[model samples]
Target: MLPRLRHAAVVAALVCALCCAPAGATYSIVACDAAGDCGAAVATHNLAVGASVIYAQAKVGAVATQFETNPQYGPKGLALLARGVAPADALQRLLEEDGGFDGGDIGERQVGLVDARGRAATHTGAAAQASAWAGARSGEGFAVQGNGLASAEVLEAMAEAYRGGRGDLSERLMAALRAGQRAGGQRIGAMSAALRVATVAGGFQDIDLRVDAAADPVADLARLDDQFHAHQAMLGAERAARSGDAAAARAQRNEALRLSHQWDRIWRRAARLAMQLGEDERALEYLGVFASANPVWAREEVDDALYARLRQRPQFVRLREGLGAQEPGG
Candidate 1:
């Protein structure tokens, strides 16, 4: 009877441990962009569980809390900043209030925040995984923190990468994430990643990407970032075309095409823009590229509304027919 009682007690303890433990081991960076926008990005080893780990309110601040994460801390910290609390003071309030839960084991939490003014703060709990080498670092415009990392060098590498990289806040944040991965990522690797940037307008200004699950989340995130830039270039081309700047439109479209050769949509858009500019040879070239990349467009005789001007061109017809011939039933 005594042995059975002991066994039941042990089982209950294990169940409680499993139920109460948060799922993710995470690394994150928060920053203020050159244009004074603020944002945050985080990567974690739990599928879809860390989306809320990083939070930002445009022109207010950004926050990321992890380790034995209490996601509520993210919003609460940001709200504190929104009310004019200093970054350090806001972090203190979070640490103080965090004591009301989980038997006051605030030492198990890690957090980082950057205010709209570029003030930064970070904290790492003593109770984080020993193998993780948990740590935090802060600089002029950024804060980086991590737990369940292979070494403390991971934290330093991220900070250095962000400080040294050029371009916008999103680019620097991505550099930091890649640096952490190269230095030695989380002990179990990552499954989900997210990047968000906010401007004074309170929306995604530059980037807002999420990878819910992937074998290599950081690498996949880099790919997504490239795709984002390609799309942005395409939009710039369209805007230039609408403004009647043919040279600028052509340059932007060519840049988009250079960035993402696999993106069939860019080829199609480039063809339409060329047609609008009356560059018939360039239009035919783009159409041929699009048809070669997207066989279905040719097989179904699908014509874009913008391509009406080119519908009767012998070169365009030949390109479409050539593409159709590659289909099984053609």
Candidate 2:
């Protein structure tokens, strides 16, 4: 009799604990451009949910599966989309395959899908936490979803931001993420955030950044995006120089250098660009900064033909000699 009573008490305690535990929350947005460039941004109270909750494949689509989240849905969903499955049908197939937390009911899962064609679909499980006020909204070329949100307005604001924001797909998606957070975001706040954008046949992502954990993940994510853009400008400078647009190349290189003056690679590349543009003094200045930051790069000989003219300059010779003197063996 006593054993039976104790068992009942234990079960009751377990039930109470389960009921009191806080539900996890995630807010996410996915958008596609007219050129079929797809991108996704997500913020969650959980660490690195972006890695699992947001999945996107170039020329296919983006997926955000959350709320009692299942990680497998990411890759599998993209694969289905790659196979030419419609967004709705792909989501349904995921539901069919996984069934649900229970036997066959997905009453607690929240998912959003957007294909390369800009077709979108969203689902919010009926059983999502009430405090979260789970909901989703879809627009012309984007979808926003949230679980454990402060209210339905969270997703609404995200959708509105995506629709009204200016700039490219990444900018619009970031604007939506900021809007969702301002609209209350998750009741518990955010710890992790991510942004990923893929261009059609571009062979590489335009933006891929993640803030795994931070006091202000969204802000950190924005900072990362700024850095990414600065780096992209540097790449543009390189390409412009290769294409014989010296004036455009110089402007782009200067812009990147202004944004990130401390980075060794940017300085090195800028030095080379200035040399090619016949800006000997500017090239020497850039090389000085690069050598100071990266002693190893100074020790290596400049082999690029673009620097042949600058290499004959007295300042260039002195810079290399100074670097060699600073070497360990020297």
Candidate 2, 16-91: lDDT as tens digits = 3466423858899987878788889999998886677887777888888877777777888889989999888887
**Tens-digit lDDT track of model 1 for 24-114:** 3688899986576787778888876346678887778899877777787888998999999999888877876775365534556678989
Give the worst 10-residue stretch by lDDT in candidate 2. 1-10
lDDT of 2: 0.77
What clash count goes with each model? 0, 1
TM match of model 2 to true structure = 0.76
* lDDT of model 1 at position 308: 60
Candidate topping lDDT: 2
TM-scores, all models, native as reference: 0.82, 0.76
> Which runs of model 2 end up more than 4 angstroms from their true locations?
1-22, 101-105, 151-153, 258-262, 284-330
